[model samples]
Target chain A: MPKIVAFACEHSAYEAATAALERKTGTAVSGENPRFPIVEVEILKVPCTGRVEVIDILKALEGGAGIVVLLGCFEEACHYLTGNVRAKKRVGYVRRIIQDIGLEENRVQFFSLAPDMDARFSGIIEELSKQVVNMGPGPVTRIRDQTTKEQAQAAQAR
Target chain B: MIVAEQKPVAEILRMIEGYRKILVVGCGTCVTVCMAGGEKEAGILASLIRMAWAREGRLGPLIDVSETTVERQCEWEFLQEISEKVAASDAVLSMGCGAGVQAMARMFEGKVILPALNTKFIGMPERQGLWTELCAGCGDCVLDRTGGICPIARCSKSLLNGPCGGSQNGKCEVSKDIDCAWQLIFDRMKSLGRLEALGAMLPPKDWSKNRDGGPRKVVREDMLL
Candidate 1:
């Protein structure tokens, strides 16, 4: 199972992402089934991507997600004038931070799309999913396994 | 406002390696304006250090990082307010300018004082998002002529007489991106019709006033210890 998380803003990006999922598969567009492969892809709808704190992104990675992608409204098209720009800057900051902490920088990415651009939106998901497949599970999962093994050995010694 | 940049996360983490209880102090005046040693920055640094320590699998000592913001660290009174918190902590991380850090060190003589940011220079805010260093604190001001471009402030060599022939097309020969300060002065003076002032030639700057013998000190008779 590919564990992916999509952080979408309340504006155009969320709507466009939903529409793209419906368009990708021939499923009926409904609230129940948004229709994207890996239905477990947790979709976090934020008020604005700019409001998504860097700590939130780090905590999500710590919680075990192979890939985390932030989707924002197109440049200059955001409901807030420079909200998307701020989001981009924060994402850039987070990318550097993740790399410094020993995580692959490519695991985190940002995509911009207008409310009606379904093709571009779908392409982004497909590309991100392919990258996740190549990278495999995140480091948190491996660290957990190692800790579990160490605990078991210590328990046996006792 | 005094500008400073946060020390790298790894370096900060290494500095506080053994300390379990830490106190993070921030100066709200100069450092706050620079977005370096402010309340927000201090909180972020403390959080990052905490996380890094947790990853080391040591279940580290009782780590207590608290924040206290002071108006100006140059005064001993503002620093004295945090005497209780300073006494309780195993180590103190100061996120103020160099002056503030030194003041903290002086106030708490035997306590370990670590600087969390590097002090850069005296500069003015260029715009909302930009700050450019404008003064080297050479203990002199010669902005009367040459339209406010201090040959001492902006020039690489701090030349006051004239361009050193290393300036080409208004750019310094040492580095391409830098605009020769003398060239800028020349243009500004020409525009103001004050080019005649350039012929006067400034004498060598007096060095006594700036870091001459040792660390600079100022005394006020009315505000004595």
Candidate 2:
């Protein structure tokens, strides 16, 4: 299963992902949140979605994440007033960049949901993991245990 | 301020191919205000190029990328900060305007400095997320007669006399969104009780003072001392 990294805003998506995990595991883990037990989802908590930038998303791809998901508050209900909106624009920009690079533009995804929407959160993770697995291996450099350059060199050697 | 736009990502990637060490330099003045070539922009472009090539499965020990932004690229004093980096890199993907690119060229002879921005025009922010051209740098000054508006910059015809026959409802023939510069001039002059000035037949503009004069220079002997 391909691991998908979601930049979950603390105000919303993180809470919802926590809720989903709590419902599944019956307890919350301290510190770093591990990958979803059922699906390969790495939930990286952020202060707000608006803080997510074009470079962040692109770097995630370069760092070996199969697909990057940006989860923020609803467009009009952004905790920072326009953080979610800014995240949306960055997501759009990354999509265009990916499209221009002749890759699957959908690798970068954006979603708006509240903290209580655990069911939706679980569904998105499962769906994304399944989607990436079906898409098979992408041209993205899988950093693995080696440096990104070394990984790319291995890929080149292939 | 001078407004500029970044060239396409693909085109930029194409420009830096085969170069071992690439330096992405951004200008902190006008291009920064316009969100084109600035420190933040330079970092973003560097990361972008790194990822794009990595995705292509061709990134190895061959190509390395670095980025820096100066306070102003057109000034030699500010450019001295990045002199060593410029000398070491195979190519510089400059995020500055055309002048900045040329300045780099003149300052560091034989170094390859590639332009990453298409220097658009002298413009000001129309609103929060919009910009509009405001000047053309014409050697002649006529704003005193045209009620503080430049017909050459705003009008499609660059007419000095008045609005062309195509102007209607204070809008230019080129587009409805564009206000006719002559209409604006007339209205401004009329409000200032200077409408009589427009009736006077002005002679033809001196074309030699413009770009037709070839590469021009402003030698201020007083300032040289």
Candidate 3:
């Protein structure tokens, strides 16, 4: 299955995502279908979404993640004052870089929500899953694997 | 400090499309302070370049990117440390100002040094994330007479004598956002009790001291000797 890397803020999205995960796990423990098993997401907790750098987003895609998401607090409600604001600007900047690189601008995404919005978190995951299903396998992984194979082949020939 | 902004990624990508290996060299001085070309920015640019090419898959050979920074690219000693990196790559993507890029180009002599920044101006930060120009570097001093306000840089017309008729509501004729330099000069001088100094009409500015001459240089005989 394709992978999705979501950088979630501990202050907001992380807690909400945790709640959603716990709810899903409980339903599965009761012998019912685990709905979230379909969407493969690796949630990395960050102190603040503002701490997310532009290079990190590119690195995630380079590391085989199908898509990258930045989840943070709402506008004017960031615990560190302007962390969310800065995160938004960084998202826009990264989007421009990837767009210029000929990739879909939607490859990178940003969202804002409170800590208690578990349902919203679930919706975001479902949306990403649908996106990847339509997009198919990411070209980044194929290109990277091909580059590695070519380098190895050149070494053997040498 | 000198201010600059990064060029669009598309333009930068176009310039390096032919090169198999590229080195992004950043300056640690003015460009870093202005948030245009710094160590972090260099990393961002390198990553973008790498990924862009990797996604291309068949644009040509895979382009590899490396990043490094110098204390000051304008000086020779600082640039010496990156000699090995410079030799390893076909093109050097300089994230420094005009002088830094030219210095690298001269030092390497054979390699291509591409500029990644558009040098903006000599200015100071007016507020958080905001920088405003304060000097024109006209090779002449006029601040002592205008109560320290620079009419050459602040005024749209670079007026030497009095406020022009275009000044309205304490703003310049260029735009409402720009404050009138004469208004600021008058207010500052009035508060300093130096308004009487304006009674004398000043002579016309000497254009020879400005950029009228081709490429001016300074020499220090005592230090050189």
Candidate 4:
């Protein structure tokens, strides 16, 4: 199972995803299962992408997330004027830092969208999920496994 | 206020790599107003380091992470207030100015103290998010003679005379971004009907009184209550 963490803006990305899911369920007749693969993602909701701090993004990666995505408002459309703009710069900063630490910068990303763009939201999620799957697990997960193994060995010795 | 910019995250992480428990300190004065090494920045940096350590599975070396913002890190009382916090941690990461870092090191004595900001200069905000250097604290202020502007601090050449002849369109020839300090001085003197003061050749500035004399100090015998 692939693990991806996405910080979804309450005003745009989160709303769009909710709306898309509702429409999918609404169109399905009784007892007909939705064909879309339910991707395993931990969605963190933020009032605005601007509120998503640089540390929050890094924490997601540290918490065994193979991929981290920031979904916010489209350019020139943020309700908070420069919310999306600020988020973009912070994401860029985090991306450069992670790259410097020997991690793939592509593991972290940002996408802008509108509240009504449900199809686009789902498309982005699917594309990111596929990309993460191809990239395999992140360094954080490997480190966790190594630490756990060492701890277990030490316990056995004790 | 003194302006500062955070050292890159990678460099900061590398600095505190070996420490198990760290206390992140912040200055609430100059750093706060400049949007640099303040309480908010301290929390952000602490969180980033913890996350990075956890990611690398170096959890053993980053057990306890604490943060505190003092009223002024450069002051002894403020450092004294967080003495217990500093003692509890293996190291201290100070989000204060250069002076604050040394103050902490002086007070703490033996702890590993790291600086999180590169203290830029004594400056004021030119706009909402822009800072411009305005003072050199030459120990001899000449603002009265130069229309409240310090040519020692602003002029590219620090010329005691008028414009260096390189000034063009009121901008410094060195960079279009910087205003010609001498031009500003001339304009101000002209408006104040004090251009005649410009002709009074000022004597050479005393070098021993400035930074060239080494670490400056102030002893207030009257304030010793």
Candidate 5:
């Protein structure tokens, strides 16, 4: 199964994700609360989506995260105006970079959310998990192992 | 400054096909200003190469990629500063102008140097993010006679006595977007009260000083320390 990394904004997606967790077990989404875990879903909370950069996404993919998703606030709803827009642009750039490097573009995605939209946040995670399962493991790890094997075979041939 | 554009990634990959360990070097001067090749671009290219090679399922060999940037790639001092890096790597992928690439090749002797950018021309920015050619380095400048406008670079034909009957509505016949060089000269000369300059017949250009002179060089013994 593919590992998925989701960079969620504190003001929006983080809250929504916490709310979704609260729906499963009667608990408040707060610093004192221990959240519920969705299978293969790793949440990285950032102050804002704007804080997330192209390098961060690229590094995640290189580090064996099969899928990288950015969860930000909707439209003009960003507390820091244009934060989501900036994140969206960066996501597009990273998507293009990965695509150029022979990775599937769909491996990187951006979704906008509201603070209270628990259902939508859960739905996005479920959808991404399904997509990751379909995509299988990323190519980086496979390539590393393949190269080691080839080198061994070449040495034996000599 | 010289303006350049990066070559296609496929061509770059092809150029370094046999090389396993590579140094992807960037220039901080002309190529960077032109957005063709810079430190950031160097990192991107290196990452792309590694990613692409990895995706190929390690068909050939283990590709080891490293990156660095010099203040100017055309200068011997700057090139020498990264001599150790160059010596460590099997080949160099230079993210610099053609001249810079040649300079490194000359300094490094037998080291394989590959150019990542195609040097376009000597130009200046027309606006933010928009660059326009302003000179052709023809070795003979006539801007003094043409009211600071370059006929050699602007005119499609490079005619000494121009307008050539191809100018329409003050625009060059080649493209409506381009202003006729002669028309611009005439207007500027008239405005500057130097209309008589246009009447002066220009002599045949001396091509000896241009590229026709094989591998041009300048030597100033007096300036030698």
Candidate 6:
């Protein structure tokens, strides 16, 4: 099973995640709150999905999350009119960064939700979790170990 | 402005093949404003090339891909600033406009100067989010009659007489959505009471002054080197 770290903002996505857990829904939806599977996933609640930075997402990848998902409010529904759009742009920047660093772009994903869509949130999480399971461990974690070794050799050479 | 667009990544990669030591030079002027051959884009391209090289299990030559310490106007002193970095590398990839690339080629005679972007056209910002090429450098500008609109500049056919028979209701035949530049000029001139000026027969444009021969040269005694 892939270790999934999901960032749910303080707004609708968190509420939906909680609702999904209460409803025992195996899927991730947008607005409705549903139940979540307890064993394979860890959820981190943030102030706002827009608050999450590219560096933070990269740190999560380095920390062994096979897949990291950013859950935020819908595009035009953010409390801040363009916050979601900004978040999308940052996500795209980080995606390019990861790809440049030789990691698959699919390791990072973004989803939007409203306060009431628990079932949809749960469904999305379930589907993404399964996808992550099939994709296996992320490339960054594997590459870091080798990079560290190379750095050690370079240090010794000096 | 020196406008340019990024070359395809695959094409850039292929051009740098077999070169171990590579120097990526970025321009900080027009290419930067256009988001093509600027510092950030140069860094991205360098990183991507490094990653691609790593995939082949061959650590590249002492590749030092860095930006040129210059603006995008092709001045010689600015090109001189990157002389040390350029000398250290085996090949150079310039992320600049065509003028900048040509300047680098001229300054560093015999050195391989590869262009990382395709030079486009001179254009101005349409509004905040768009840019439209309005000038064609026809060697003659007639902004007097059309209220600053150059029919030669914006018209698809460069029609100086009247809108071709293809014009419909004031839009160009080439594109229905675009207002005919000639029509816009005529309307503006007519409103300005300059319509009678348009009735005067203008002679045929001198094509020899444009590009009939080889490259054109302009000499200014006041700015002589």
Clashing pairs in 5: none
The digit string of per-residue lDDT tens for model 1 on A66-155 reads: 777788988888787888888888788878866654567877778887777666766666676677778866666444555778889999
Least accurate stretch of 10 residues (summed lDDT) in model 6 chain B?
A: B60-69
DockQ (0 to 1) for model 6: 0.16
Candidate 5 ranges with C-alpha deviation above 4 Å: A5-57, A69-100, A110-122, A145-158, B59-62, B169-171, B176-179, B183-196
lDDT of 1 by residue, B1-225 (tens): 677888877777778878878898988888899888887777666655554444454332355666778877768999999999999998999999999989999999889999989999888777865776788776767788658887776888888787898999999888998889999999999999998988886677787877776877778999997
In the range B152-210, model 2's lDDT, one tens digit per residue, is 89989888878899999999999999999999999999999999988888788876788
C-alpha displacement of B86 in model 5, angstroms? 1.1
Question: What does candidate 2's lDDT look like per residue over A1-158, in tens digits?
Answer: 46577999998988988887778732132322233444355678999998987778877776667789998899778888999988998898888877777668888999998988877877777677777776644455443333656668999999
Preferred candidate (DockQ higher): 1 or 6: 1
What RMSD does each model have against the real structure? 4.5, 3.5, 3.7, 3.8, 4.9, 6.3
Candidate 5 Cα deviation (angstroms), residue B66: 1.1
The full ranking of all candidates by DockQ, starting with the best, is 3, 2, 5, 4, 1, 6
What TM-score, to 2 decimals, does candidate 4 have? Answer: 0.86
lDDT per residue for candidate 5 within A1-158, as digits (tens), equals 35678899999999988887778532233322223233366788899999986767876776667788999999998989998999998888778767766688988999999888888877777777777777865677567666678889999999
Model 1's CAPRI class is incorrect
Alpha carbon lDDT of each predicted model: 0.75, 0.82, 0.84, 0.82, 0.82, 0.74
- Indicate the DockQ of the complex predicted as candidate 3: 0.58
Best by TM-score: 3
Give each prediction's DockQ, rounded to 2 decimals. 0.19, 0.46, 0.58, 0.36, 0.37, 0.16
Residue-level lDDT for A115 in candidate 1: 72
Q: Which tens-of-lDDT digit does each residue in B43-79 have in candidate 6?
A: 6677556545544444423543444535653888888
Superposed model 4: Cα runs more than 4 Å off: A25-39, A134-142, A152-158, B61-65, B191-193
